[model samples]
Target: MRTDSGLRLEADPRPPRALPPVPSAIQGDTPLSRPKKKKPRTKNTLGSASSEGLAQAPVHRPSEGSELPAKEPAEHPEEAPIQRRQRKTRLPLELETSFTQKKASNSSLLRNENGIHVEPPEEAVTQKPRRKTKKTQPAEIQYANELGVEDEDIITDEQSSPEQQSIFTAPTGISQPVGKVFVEKSRRFQAADRSELIKTTENAEVFVDVKLSWTTRDVALTVHRAFRMIGLFSHGFLAGCAVWNIVFIYVLAGDQLSNLSNLLQQYKTLAYPFQSLLYLLLALSTVSTFDRIDFAKTSVAIRNFLALDPTALASFLYFTALTLSLSQQMTSDRIHLYTPSSVNGSLWAAGVEEQVLQPWIVVNLVVALLVGLSWLFLSYWPGMDLSEELMFSSDVEEYPEKDKGLKASS
Candidate 1:
């Protein structure tokens, strides 16, 4: 409408608009329909100022018939600190129904809050019973008749009386079964318990399978055979020495003491060969002992000797010969010496010293060198035999064997 003279003409007053109908489903309160609003942050100072303004500002409620707020709403700024919260739109029946169905679902839950459904455990399954054994009348009279027989006779004719009662049937408080009489006797013979006793099916026959089978004779035979191999080794050396020792002791000494003179008389026969043989046996035994030493007292030397080659046996023997030679020289030299010329022509005439001394020294020196060389060969490798040769050359000069017979009579 146009206004004249700067005065506007007012339009006629308009009737109030009718509100849209609220949905029936949206009418009820629901958790999903609750209001959702953005929180507005305000400075603490401005918030307090607003609060004071609110307290000072007048609040006017709407008239009784009015559907609007009781008081006129406060004017809000474009970006007001106080927010008017908008209520959430209520969901349709289909969405609410889906929600209700999800709540009722047990797929993602343990159970309903109200209760849980449970089925009773299945009853124990029944099984068919086994058939009962048939019962036969016991022959008590037959047992009584057998019991009447002497106890000793029962052993002789064990099965002759049939229908005998089981040992368990005896009324008295007997510890053993009555039927095991022969078994008990057998156990006594076996020197064992009842479990060890055996019974024969026929005629209560009993026999003892004694464990006393390992007799001394059998063990001795086994031991002898085992040691026989060791004996062979020892006996071989003995055989070789026997003749040598005997001849050196008897024939050689006999001839040497017969009579010879001068430097020749200084010589005597020596039993170095026999001494070597004895030492060899000792070495072999030591080797065997090394291998056979009981668990309690084994030594490293014994272990080494056992593993040593058989050829080493000869080396051991040779070393033994050298040791015996050295020992004999030391022992023989300790004996009191005599010059035959110092005695009467008759007493010195026998030429005992001339018969004995020089030859023995020569032989002993030779044996010692041989043994020492052998020991060196075994003890040190490469240039080992050279050491022995040098020693031999040096010691050999001590013996002068130009004479044949030179042993004094003992």
Candidate 2:
């Protein structure tokens, strides 16, 4: 078109093209900038490939407008048709978070100096809530600074050798619980006080006092060994008593006594006393023995005390009953005896009543009661059990001081 001035200006009559849609500054990320995900790998066989080929391009094609039969889409097929994926939504940070969106809705919009809308940061708030909290200052450090502690005085880790540096030590006693009291490992075992043991090294968990030596462990082991020896001896003694009780019963109750000579018949004297002596021996024995050993219950040796032997109880009860039986039989079944007078008539004579069950049977029963009950009570004594536990804990496996002392000595 020519202008009125006859300046031929051929301008395109079409209106100027509209500018592209302006991108928002608040837009978080573009689809292209977002990380691409890798597809999982899969193996294929010729059969699958051929099946897919046959399914897609069917041998007999359906007539126009007729739908293809329902078939699964190929995982990856050759000569694939072009397909466009729907554009992914890349919402801005402001829109992605519901919290930020709510806040932005509630808060007035902020504008840059250029009068352009600028989205506030996700965490940005118009006003922050004032929280009342006590602000503590290092008063000690400040005091030290006022005192003008020099760099030399403020010793750092680099300033000292490892031997001089403080170590982490747990509190053993009330007197020193606050600071890290680094105690050197005294290759020598004992300290004057229990607190000293704990302060010396942190590994020793128990604090126990001893009578003579700081070597509580050695004392305990020695004690256990002594008890073990005593138990072994007592066990043998008690077993002997039990067996002899049966023999004693056989001699007294049966006719075996008549077969032996008078001097050998003195065996009756030894056997009868052994019945009562069995209880005496058992009283000393059971407490020394251990029923079971368990380290879980205690780091020490035995957790359970030895129980009373059933054989001892049975043997004693049977013997006591036998003595009572003979006494009763002598009283009820004794023969009334008579002797003819030297010159004239028949005269009355002493019979077997006194010979069989004497007044001493009562004494025997009383002694039996005392010994048996005492044995039972001592076997289950809580105090004795407790003492054993304490001893084992202090001395059984490793008393820290004794263990260290031996090592040092060795």
Candidate 3:
């Protein structure tokens, strides 16, 4: 186009070409610098030249509708399909075979994580070879993993005989099936069974049922044996006390049997001596029986023993006091018999007079006897069982009907 200026000047007539469409990613009109081409590697001239040409092609270029070059995709058609065929075939034959084999193996197992058997498609087995294929290739060896078998535990029944793979021999305590039988007979043997074993072991670790081995009678016998040792010492002390009491009574009687009953009565104050023996027996029996009991229950028993009902103790005390009172009265009566006014004064002059010495000696003898008897009984008495009801259960509290209703309302 000519410019209006007749100086023969051609007008700079070209309008600004519409800018090429810039991708939103590229900012402003400034043209983006292209990446520099890498220098061709000098080492291995042929490989460098080929690589250079490939590298020089535009990178990050948008894909066009152009078709990729056609080429042979894989060397083996029997295995995984060539990359080219994989895109077109929705389901590969090798995968279908693996799925079928897994389903067959899983069906025979007695238990599974999913709990139910899912039958496989018939096409899987029909299309694949039935005979076991020798795992010559790396891909074939990994077929088990692809078939839902864990990598850590991919045992093949074909690899080892049933006897060689047996885990348990005696099967002594196991209530479950024999290991060898399960492996040989069960269709599910090859699949993962660790989940079941894991659950069982976890339960065992937390809770175990301890058989009630010793019956109540057996426990009682054990208690008796243990208390016997304590009884020996207590009984001996009681005997010694009895002997001492007898000797004191004889001497207190002043060689006269006439006032013996009275002398025994006077020694009533000595009754409390038997209490020591009773307490000792009680202590020994409790220690023996309680030691064998569960540690958690021991405290309850001890509290019960310590907090013995006052009424029980009072009843025994009343009887003891009565006996002492009677003995004391008898001694007083005997002393009266030997008083200067009674019959024995005339015969008593020579030996400090039996009357004078008798009462004193009898009292000491009674005291010893009571003390010894008390100790003996104490050491042999069995203690109470306070925690028998408390330890009846060890489970968590169950929600009562009322509580359940309240929860529902909430």
Candidate 4:
């Protein structure tokens, strides 16, 4: 290492290794030369470069034993300004890699900024069979894609990544969404506490049916020509009672008010108690044994239950009718008012007062009986009761292809 002189000097072992070239986008900005950043991430993550002034990053891929990195809780500190600009444009980073990474198709012999050869991650991370999801909606797919490294935090916005964003976008438009331009929120992820774990249901190891004797859903279909009889039977019976009282007591019960009143009173004594008792029991059985008692981690059973279609329209209709009927003071007074006026074992005949109750009694019966039928107005009801599906201990999570086929067949 002599420099045009007789005297010669040996070169230093560490001759200030040359720094990597900066992207034109970041050439003017000062770079962050923090010593802590010089350390490579323990797993798969972006690498950083040394800059002069502002912490302008220049792209560098980590070495083979490189660590993994997270996204957006903090920006990729190692991403070059050009990459950032490209990323900010809503263009996918993975898409860019897909195009430029063709050479790695044959081998993992890819060179980084330092001329060090490293294994390409496209095969392992990017190119893979896409898993089928229950929901294939674009927004839902985007949300699932975010479940990669930073999956814990569901960005309430549509996000695209190599994991999602379609297997291949048209070579033109490049109109893929990348957590950039936000779409108006449609209320997908509403987590009060993102850190909170979902409340999982206590499922039995074996598939057991508590109400095996009550009736299988098939019987309901045979009788009512409806698969789910829980709703049909419960509501129809009540509606029938209302229609019966309306026709006979309200319309046919003419001048014989006293006779009609007594008949109605006798009929109601048995019917009223039965209806009330059935309502309670019906609610209980449907809630307990109707479903598998299953719920999703993100799904709130009650919220999803009510939000199926016209939110609250179904509930409002049935409940409103129920409230009106119950509030009539008729159900409460039916016992006292309809009771015979007797004293000292002597009865006085009431030809006028008792005979003129056709209007009052008719109105009372209509409201009380029709209360059960109100549920019929509810339409487009969704399967809110996930518990309907029976789960077994033998059926494990991440069901294998065979298990799925068996379940589907069953």
Which lDDT tens digits does candidate 3 get at residues 30-149? 112111111121121122223332332222011110221112112222422222222112112222223323344444221222233332443232212211111122232233223332
Model 3 segments more than 4 A misplaced: 1-209, 214-217, 248-271, 274-410
TM-score of 4: 0.27
Residue 9 in candidate 2, Cα distance off native in Å: 99
Report the C-alpha lDDT of model 2 over 1-410, residue by residue, as the tens digit. Answer: 11111100000110010011212211112212222420110011111322332332321123101321122114222211211010101111111112222233433312221223343343122111100000121223222222221221122322223343235422212121222223346674432443443444332222322334457567766777677567546655555555454454445534633432231234334533454465456554544433223223443332232233333343344345345434433222221222222324433222332344234334334434533443444345322433455446644556787888999999
Higher-TM-score candidate of 3 and 4: 4
In model 3, state the lDDT of residue 40: 24
lDDT of every model, 2 decimals: 0.31, 0.32, 0.34, 0.34
Best by TM-score: 4
**Candidate 2 deviant stretches above 4 angstroms:** 1-214, 255-268, 271-280, 289-391, 394-410
Could you list the CA RMSD of all candidates, in the order they appear?
40.9, 28.6, 28.6, 21.5
Q: Give the worst 10-residue stretch by lDDT in candidate 1.
A: 125-134
- CA error at residue 181 for candidate 4, angstroms: 67
- For model 2, how big is the CA root-mean-square deviation? 28.6
TM-score of each: 0.20, 0.23, 0.23, 0.27
Clash total of candidate 2 = 1
Taking the tens digit of each residue's C-alpha lDDT, what string does model 4 give over 1-410?
Answer: 11111000000111111112222222222222312332232111221111211121121122101211233213445554433332222112121123222232324212221224343343222111111111122332232222222211222223223333344432212233233322235755433321121111112211233445444554542443233455545555555555655555545345545355455455556545644654553443233222312333224445544675332334433444455444544443454344554434323234533544445565556554434333443333444334333332223354687787999999
Q: Is candidate 1 or candidate 2 better by TM-score?
A: 2
